[model samples]
Target: MCATLVGGMDRLKREYINAAKANGVELKVFTGKENCISEKMGQTELVIVFTNKVSHAARKEVMHYAKSRNIPVRLVHNCGVSSLRQNLATN
Candidate 1:
């Protein structure tokens, strides 16, 4: 599976990436409000937003892209690695 993660600290990002890799998931992370390309969206299976850290515009864009492609999205307030892992495990 491929996942797009928006926002999180460097340490948390590393941990989250490691966790995803361990679970056989490829993760693409964005820490800023930059727009994602359609080619990238094509490879993404899910979108995870760390609500407290990401900008509203970035979140909206991601949600819009995912919705257009019918990909699943998970919104979590915390940007911790454990929270991300837990959310990802459900889907």
Candidate 2:
């Protein structure tokens, strides 16, 4: 499965990707500081937003884009690797 992660610590980006990969997910991560995130995030099956770490504008933009495309969006308040892994495991 493929997923796009919005927000979370930039330093832990590698760890996040690794964790997702371990669970058979191809993860693309955006640290919420990039410009035009919606455009940059290519085709993805799931959109995971770290609500606590992401800017309101970025979150809104991602959510809007995901909704329009009919993609599943998961909002996680805790921006931890474990939290992400847990969510992915369920799906």
Best by TM-score: 2
Question: What global local distance difference test value does model 2 have?
Answer: 0.96
**lDDT of candidate 2 over 1-91, digit per residue (tens):** 8999999999999999999999999999999989899999899999999999999999999999999999999999999999999989999
Q: What are the models' TM-scores?
A: 0.86, 0.98
- The regions of model 1 sitting more than 4 angstroms off are 35-42
Q: Number of the top candidate by lDDT? A: 2
Error of 2 at 8 (Å): 0.2
Tens-place lDDT per residue, model 1, 1-91, is 8988887776576788898998788888887456664345558888888999888787888888888889888999989888888878888
Q: Write down the lDDT of every candidate, Cα atoms only.
A: 0.81, 0.96
Candidate 2, backbone clash total: 0
Sliding window of 10 residues with minimal summed lDDT for model 1: 32-41
